[model samples]
Target: MSNQTSVTEFLLLGVTDIQELNPILFVIFFTIYFVNITGNGAILMIVILASRLSFCGPNHVHHFFCDIKPLLDLACGNTELNLWLLNTVTGTIALTPFFLTFLSYFYIITYLFLKTHSCTMLHKALSTCASHFMVVILLYVPVLFTYIRPASGSSLDQDRIIAIMYSVVTPALNPLIYTLRNKEVRNALNRKVRRWL
Candidate 1:
């Protein structure tokens, strides 16, 4: 039998079909890339400035953005150190907010149960948290599914789709969810339209 090995290099397709549209596509993608970086960078700066989040690393990112899995993928040599960092350092940084959110909600619910007999007040408190909770679920579930596993080349497309769910789809829907549910945002929008009119 003949021996065969898998190819090391692979090309991502369907991105550059028409030659004339190249610059237009480049401009569009560049704008998107710049916006994505600026927005996330602002958030990262806020988190680091406000909290104790820190990073020092072998700095070559594999994905379009500086995300955990992609950075790990780009690491040279054995990935043991990278994986350890992911498990310990990165995991703590990521999960701290989630844990704190849960803790705060637990306190809220406990207080509502023990102190409040009014169903109206309980419902109002829970309703406010519901929107935030939905957003958290939308973001975290897909991310956890995508990253918290053994990495391999076999499921790249599936991983990309799941990544898009949280990175693109969830963020796109967040404003809509907030605007629909939040009276303050709706009122501000209405006021702006009235002013322009």
Candidate 2:
């Protein structure tokens, strides 16, 4: 008889290899994972209640947080259904917001060019969308690179790098982008600074 056993669980390659660092890593990653869930869950809830978004699941994740690609990577049984959902359901979740954002900018540009015909207004509108657009690009480009292909082509190391790019780097830069580009945020910050002085 063949002693073939299927994989039932996965151990993620965490941030460190040192046994002593395990506890610290756990705490840090747990906090990050918790916040990631809380934040994304809030958005999911909003989408669910406001619109009609749904998700079904299996219970393994290769990445630190419950990102879709990582979770799919750990699917214990055949991943046909999971892959389908990734294409249809997850694709909708990921791409719809991007498409809508794109359309909004498209309309804004169209209105500015055809209706308004003001270079100053056009520049202002583009500038207003710039930060948001940059954030979207930062997030979605990596995601598309990671998920928009057949899973067989994905390298775990590559996925990890890109995952960090979208998950950590994009979120970290978002506020900076907003603050730098947004006069309103700058003014509010200046007001607070003056008061503190």
Candidate 3:
């Protein structure tokens, strides 16, 4: 009797069912990849560039991949340590954004009620922060749901749906949310387009 168990790495079967759909899938995903990278990268860049961009504090992140916890699944051997690290890292990544968003709105409300006492400014701030916060929550909650909890014998469909939610849907919605909600940004874009034309 052998007391050996085989461990295999999980392979991502990303929508390869219909052979005829390969090219279409490739085009679609390629566009999504571009949008996700560019959109997130641009937001990060803007945050870095703007001195006024405020957060609670500086935190050092120690994950190989920029996006967060999925790299832990790629560990070759015993994944205990990797899983622990991923949980800690992913938990912070998931919770901090939500907390900050809440705090931002809290301050905006406080500021509205306390200082200046103007409903218009408060409404604008609330509208702006709410839109951004909604997008952030939508992006992070699915990731936390998929990764943070203990892994169980679940079908790949669940994981695929989550991945699509965070990656494709979130990215697609980000530009629209930011553009539609922020009047300043919308006006700036219009001005830029007029200048270009």
**Highest lDDT: which candidate?**
2
Clashing pairs in 1: none
lDDT of 3 by residue, 85-121 (tens): 5555557656766788778778877777788567788
lDDT of 2 by residue, 136-182 (tens): 89988887787677887888778889988988999999889987776
Task: Order the candidate numbers by TM-score, best to worst.
Answer: 2, 1, 3
All candidates' TM-scores? 0.53, 0.56, 0.48
**1 against 2, candidate with superior lDDT:** 2
Model 2 poorest ten-residue lDDT run: 46-55
Off by over 4 Å in 2: 1-62, 66-68, 71-77, 182-197
Best by TM-score: 2
Better TM-score candidate (2, 3): 2
Q: Residue 46 of model 1: what lDDT?
A: 39
Task: Summarize candidate 1's per-residue lDDT along 1-197 as a digit string, tens digits.
Answer: 76585654433224667878878877887897986686566556534432332335556553446565565454444655455444444344456667888898899889988999999998988888888888888877786666455565326556667878878999998888877676888888889999999
Superposition error at 128 for model 2 (Å):
1.4
